[model samples]
Target: METQNLGSSPDVRSKNESVKSVDRRNFLRSAGMTTVAGAVFLAGCDKDDDMTPTPTSVDLGSGDVGILNYAYALEQLEAAFYTQVVATPFSGITDAERSMLTDIRDHEIIHRDFLKAALGNNAIAGLEVNFSSIDFTSRASVLGAAKLFEDTGVQAYNGAGNLIKDANYLLIAGKIVSVEARHAAAIRDLLMPNSTSFAGDDIIDAKGLDKAVKPADILAAVKPYVKTTITASNLPTS
Candidate 1:
C-alpha cells in the first residue's frame, strides 16, 4: 500500500515520511481545487447553472509541480466519481459489487492524497466534480464511467512517466500506475465477465504496452466530470 521509495537522501526520506500517514478522506474534503496554467475557474454561479458548474480552465503549472498537479486533478475526479457511485448504489447492486466499488473509491482517495502530500504547497486547490452527466442509480451507467476513468488513469500515468526527471517521482508513479491498471482490469471485468476483456485492444498496443495518453487528451476526456475547463498549456509534453 506504500508508495515506491523516492530515494535514500535525507530530504527525500523526510518528504516520504509525510506520505505514510496521510488521511485521504480528510485531505480530499479540506483541499480546494486550484487553477493554474493561467487558466480561470468559474466562481460565479447563476440561475441557468442549477448544479451545472461552468468553471474556467485549470492551468497546471510547469515542471514537476505541474505534473503533480495534473495527477492530482485526475485523482480528484476519480475520487469524486467513485464517492458518488458508492453513495448511491444502483438498485440491483450486489454486496460483492458494493464492496469492490468501495475499495476502488478508497484507492482513488489514497492516490489523490499521496499526490497532494508529495506536492505540498505546490499542489493545486481541490477540484469540484460535476457528476450530473451520470445516472448514479443505474449499474451500467456507473460501470461505464468507472471503466473510462480507471483506464484513462492508467494511460495518464504511463504517458507522463518518461517526462518525470526525479527517480523517486518516477518510482512513485510506477507504483500508482500498477494499481490503476488493476482497477482498470477490475472495472473491465465488471463490465464483461471474461474473454480478454481486461486487456482490450483499444488500450493495448502491438508492442504489448499499455497506451500512453497525453495530458491534453486526458483533460478533455474527463472534462464532463469536472466543472472547470482545464488547460495543460504548461504541462511537460515530452
Candidate 2:
C-alpha cells in the first residue's frame, strides 16, 4: 500500500528539466518543428485493476491525442497483466510480491483511466489482450512478462514525449514514466534476486538514460498480445 503513492516520492516528483529540455528541443529541431528554448516539465500526480474487455481494434488517431491513445493502449495491457497476476497469482508468490504487484495493478488502472479522461472522445477504443503466451501459474513467466511490459511502457512514454506538443501531456507522461520505472525496478529485482538487471545495458544507455522507442517498434513488440492492427503511420516522427 505504501508503494501506491510511488509517483509522489521525492525521486519521481523532482523534475529533470535540464536534461529533458535539451532532448525535447533537439527532438523538435530534428523533426523540423518549432522550438521552445527552455521547455518546462509538467509535474502532476492516483487506483483499481480493470480486467474487462475493451474494444479489440482501435486506431491511435493522430497528434497529441493520438500519443495519449498510444499510452492508453500500453496502460490497458499493463493493467490487465497485473490484474491477472494478482487474480491468479503464480505459484510460490510471496506476500511481498502480491502486495507490490497489487499496488502496481492499481497504478496501471489509474493510468488507463487518467488517459481516458484526458483524451475523452479523442481516445481510442479499449484494447482486448491475449495472454495465452504467458504461463500465469509460473512465477518466472509472470515476472518475465511484467518486466517486458514495464520496461517497454517506460520506453514508450519516453519516445512518445517528443511527439506530444502539449506541455500538459508531456508533464503527465513524465509522471507516469517515473512510476513505470519503479515497476520495472521492482519486477526486475524479483526476477533476478540481488542482480542489477533493473537498469542493465540492454534497456538503459551508457549515459544512464532509458532508450526511447518508436511507436512502430512499440506496436510490434506488443502486436502478438492484441489481435488488432495498430495503425500508427500518422503519429509524429523524430
Highest TM-score against the true fold, candidate: 2
Model 2 scores worst on lDDT over the 10 consecutive residues at 1-10
- Please estimate how well model 1 matches the true structure, expressed as its whole-model Cα lDDT: 0.70
For model 2, name the residue pairs that clash. none
**Residue lDDT tens for model 1, 1-238:** 1111111222322333333213322332223122111111211111132353434666789888898899989998998899888989977666656767777787777777677767766767666788887778877778878888888899899889888888988877887787778778766665665248789778898999899988888787888788766767887877
Q: Local error of candidate 2 at 203, Å?
A: 1.1
Query: Could you tally the backbone clashes for each prediction?
Result: 11, 0
TM-score of each: 0.76, 0.77
Best by lDDT: 2
What lDDT, from 0 to 1, does candidate 2 have? Answer: 0.71
State the lDDT at 51 in candidate 2: 62
